[model samples]
Target: MEDLIEDKRQQTGEINLLDIECLGLINPRNTYAITILIYFLENSQDWSVRQEAARILGEIAFGNSEAINALLKVVRTTVHDELAASPDFTPNLESNSQIEFKQLLISSKILHNKPNLDFRASESLYKIDPGNQEAIKALINLSFWHISAWCTHDDAIELLKQIAIGKPEVILKLKKQLQSNNESVRGASAEIIVTVEPNNQEAINILIELLCNGGEILEETQDFFTGKRILEHIFKAIVNLPSPL
Candidate 1:
């Protein structure tokens, strides 16, 4: 496995597609494979290879502390890197008219800057530790910025719904996010809370508020499109409610 990874790195500056395909055929539980996978996950320059390694580790090393720690590290490092690259947005009295435009621009920058590695690692962490706080937090934060691109927002909310079941702390956090100043964050949180507790009046109310006041809340044209996407989620959640609002 090491030879294949190294050869691909030396030849193509990345693991070859065929080599990755072949590697996937190997037994995930092989101890030697785990060591090599972890090495590549941390050291490989190729993000796709690192992502695959993280995924395999999650599948094979269910209770392994070393594997869990590695996944956590990936989550932390990727998030940090992405945030550092995000465009800063600051509006002054003179620039008030540009606030909405800048918000849309910043959101676009963040969405494109995020790597798939963090999402993969977060998913792996959840696999190994069902209610891991870091994993849940990572997903929630990703949901807030990603919107509909790559289905990231939907996927994160789905996982959060799974984690929130029988987990009061997770539910509590979702409830708190309902009050987030960011419209996307509030929408994502409300979606999760409503999914978990269909009759959650607070969640339902927030969704309704977003639908009714989205244009006023998000003044820019592009931002309203974002709000429109959130409205789609809101309508879906409302439709799925066991009881009507």
Candidate 2:
């Protein structure tokens, strides 16, 4: 079967044979299938084939370090900004060729939006091991738009509480972002700070500063209140903080 695949590759210059092989190997119990997929991933000339191999690797590898390592190798080598000579590079191609091109396009968009394949790999790793700190930190390094929604949720609040206790430096990173010239960055930093440390004097002082000398405050409309009064939220947080001794 391996020789047949190599012969087909040499004749057709495509990975259709390997694609079929990968489909058969999707079962988690098939270790040899995983090994073959990793081989294709590492050595396939066509990146689209490599990408399909990556997806399957993420699925079947689960918590397997060997699988994770192969995927991470792909993640490291897969340049995100790679673009075809034309956006519509599928012209005059066979069905399999078109499929491969489409896969390449998907891979490009995934990397472009998420910033890197490593981030995607980390997400997959996290799915495999929820407590993987490396995965957690990798996800945390993503942009606010990528990693968080605008509104606070119970899970997010709980996570913040946990991070405050175990990894206070994660909270401190927000303080560094406060110095950013971008108002969105500054606003988000202040907002999360207040959420995490409502009683913290330093956080309160920063919020007060934002309220007094505002550039770009996050605006939210709650029950007919439509204004950029982030300071009010800060004030309310201060008011709600437990009274001092």
Candidate 3:
């Protein structure tokens, strides 16, 4: 795979395989080689390559030292305008001192924009222990959109609430979205009920309120759970903890 990357990196124009090299390192089919590549990316002075490497590491969110360091740089980078990302972020030059063309931001965008791309996190902590809190915590910061509609009902909800505690912006939007007039929002609301409670009392009161209120969500194509099961999930939450986290 790397040989393929090397061949393409020597391209006269934009390196066609630049992204492939980064992706391979992100979630490589091989471990030792990829780890070395990741370290190399982390140490590279070129912000372009560093940015791409950071994005791939961010996807892991497992806080492995090297991966965590790379991702921390990205979290900081996202906040900066022309963030002093890579110490060597310079334009490429051709033989005549003419500016050459090559940009790593494009590749970085794909990886960062889609943190839950799944394949990237393979063989890491997420693969071994799906419930690692650190990774979930990182997702709260970087990957809310993907988590918002994921199939994990209760766990997804909890993660959202945890995130909301720190980021009111995300919570307000998500909660407001929960009751959005859209049918999908109505259905998707179920995904977070277990996880969106701001506090225990609020969670408990909402559960009680929902049960009495039928957990009604605009009465769309389907009645929430199964039409007959309007409040099954919420009711279960009420019955089990009576006050979710």
Q: TM-score: which candidate is best?
A: 1
User: Could you give candidate 3's per-residue lDDT for residues 40-132 as a string of tens digits?
Assistant: 454554445544544444343344555544343333333232324433335343444222222355335434433332212221333334444
Off by over 4 Å in 3: 13-65, 76-78, 81-135, 141-201, 204-245
TM per prediction: 0.73, 0.41, 0.34
| Span of ten consecutive residues with least summed lDDT in model 3 | 114-123
Better of 1 and 3 by lDDT: 1
> Taking the tens digit of each residue's C-alpha lDDT, what string does model 2 give over 1-245?
45566677799986463554454454463566567777876666554566566556656666777777765553344333333323544444566966887877765554453344454455556555545665544434342322222232222333444554445676777678777765445554555666667666666666677666533443332322222434454556556666778
What ranking of all candidate models by TM-score puts the best one first?
1, 2, 3
* Model 2 / residue 3 / CA error / Å: 13
Error of 3 at 112 (Å): 12
lDDT of 3: 0.43
Residue 209 alpha-carbon offset, candidate 1, angstroms: 0.2
Itemize residue pairs with steric clashes in candidate 1.
none
Worst 10 residues of 2 by lDDT: 145-154
